[model samples]
Target chain A: MPQLDPTSFSPQLFWLAIAFILLYLLMSRLVLPRVGKVLGQREERIQGNLEKAVKLKAEAEEVLAAYQKSIADARAEAHSALNQAAAEIAAATAAREADFARKLAEQTAVAESRIKVSKTQALADIRTVAGDLAAAMTSKLTGVTVNGSDAGGAVEAVLKERA
Target chain B: MAAEHHSPLEQFRVEHIGGNLSLGGYDISFNNSALWMLIAVAAITVFMLVGIRKQAVVPGRWQALVEFLYDFVANMLKENVGNEGRKYFPWVFSIFMFVLFCNLFGLLPNSFTVTSHIIVTFALALMVFIIVTAIGFIRHGLHFLSFFVPKGAPAWLLPLMIPIEIISYFIRPMSLSVRLFANMVAGHVMLVVLGSFVLPLGLAGAYISGIVPVAAITAIIGLEFLIACLQAYVFTILTCIYLNDAVHMNH
Candidate 1:
């Protein structure tokens, strides 16, 4: 066995250091930074996707609310139209009944001949009262004209003849 | 007989590469140190490639192990170096793997301890030193010199403090290299010496003495294996510290 020499300076250390430094530089400059860039880019993309999802969710919610509101408006409009049709039907039926009653009363007067004047007076009063009530309701409900002169004069003439 | 008993450490020597170049009386050779270094790199490459080639969402056993190591190093860098430090994780990770591979390879039967040599450890330490120093200068320029002169010291103590700081700054590579080399060399030497005792006992016709030496060698070998890993850890952690100084230029 050769005697160990402690004082000897090993030159291999110098070359090894050089090689290591070169390798370290390669790793630091080339490899590491590229990986880091990829990771950072991935994180940014994920955040951007999350933001898009949130925006999309908000937009979907807004669309949903708008759709619900329009549906409610359509329901209300349908209900009002149905009520107006029913009211018109009732008014038409009542007008038809009034005409029928008037004709029947005229026929009764013709058949009897004794109370013809009283029956005509009573029929005129009933028609005048109905006109006045309709005009008042129209004026109150729709802010429209409700004239009383013609109805009042007829009603008063009928009452005087009866007296 | 005494001379016939040769130490196993004699295997490590500097030899000329291609047996030709002799520049300024220095033989530039690919020695045991270089051989082990190449082996370390090859081992790491094989391990990583083989372990990660078939990456599954539900990973196999080997893939799981590789992912665990990757996450361990990544998390360590994130915790110690911060988010910005994550940028340098690959380099740090490479250093760790290379050192760990070399250390583990050295522990095999009849294998050379590359890290036990001062040259290899010094090379690694010098790299950490140079990179950190360069980063400091690049980041701060002339102002980075102020790192040696710590803040909060009295102006009257500037002269004394400056030299102390400079000495300590210069000692970074020395401490880094010495810590790893000394630990590796000492641990391996102890194991070898203990193992040799078993041979001597057997030759002396003392079977009882052989038992103690054999048990001691076994225990020492186990301890040396642990030391191998520990030295690598120490080297990597020191590298991180040095890098922190560069990135922050705080010291």
Candidate 2:
């Protein structure tokens, strides 16, 4: 086989060097930046999503707390209203009962007074009729003048003897 | 193997130059290897320039094909190097394209495989080694030397450890060049030897014997084509890994 050596400082090394430099430039200036940009974009997107999730979670917790508080306030208000209504009903019923009892007592007292006045008037009318009958009998029998007072006393004495 | 006819290597033989020029030291004789190298370089330049000359948004077939290769190498760099290390894409891309073109050009009928030569492959490997080393030193200086030292080794094992590191470092270029050259040479030789047998076997035997050599040649040629692409890929990827080691020094 023949020896396979090239002359030193040939165009071969120059071409190789040129190619290497060109390759290095293309990589550094063009290709590398695109790749790096893509990766950086991806990382930013992931981090943004994470932060959004955290914010949403905080907002949800706040809403839940507010809802719970409102429900508790409503329940307390309902209980207070129910208590007030019950107390009002009890007071009204007690007042009605007291009024009814007072009216009944006044009606009973008026009836009892009317019965006593009627009985007194009836007894007075009976006494006058008896006195008139005594006076007429004394005048006829004695054929003499008799006083009104003497007649009245004789009638009362006769009635007492008959009882 | 037979004296009846010539071998395929005959075409690649170096002939003596009888020119009167006093360029004594200059081996003005052109061989198969040099022809293929020029062809590879031309093929790459023409393919890329022609493919993107139109610069169409919706690219043609040639443009699409070229673009695919571009994107492929770009993605390979990004995947290996990560975000911070993506700055070296141009160097990696050019290496991949040039090597790929060289390997593919050799696959053509009667074309020489320059990568099959150890000197050519060594030059490629040497460039990678030198560039990566320089980059490492520039980036980390003496700190880059720490890449050779294993973190978990015992103090007593420094003697064994240091030698292993040195050997491993030296073997990088050797392994890188040899792997490419050997694979390319072996594939080409197999195809040529098998193809030569086809003609000799055809003339000496019955017509039916032609089928065997034909089938074998076809299979070997197909495998060679595949290998051409694979060897280029292997060469490019290894260079990337070596560059990564220099840049990051992860170990």
What lDDT score is found at residue B232 in candidate 1?
75
Where does candidate 2 stray beyond 4 Å? A1-163, B1-5, B11-32, B54-60
Tens digits of per-residue lDDT for model 1 on B99-210?
A: 7777888788777767777767777788788887898898789988899888999999999999999899999999998888778777776777777788779778757777
lDDT of 1 at A142: 88
**Model no. 2, DockQ:** 0.09
Superposed on all Cα atoms, model 2 deviates from the true structure by an RMSD in Å of: 8.3
lDDT of 1 by residue, A1-163 (tens): 1112332224456555544555556445654444444445556878899999999999999999999999999999999999999999999999999999999999987877757777888787776776697668778998988678764665567667988
TM-score of chain B of each: 0.90, 0.88
Clashing pairs in 2: A27-B90
Query: Whole-model Cα lDDT per candidate?
Result: 0.71, 0.70
- Ten-residue segment with the worst summed lDDT in candidate 2 chain B? B14-23
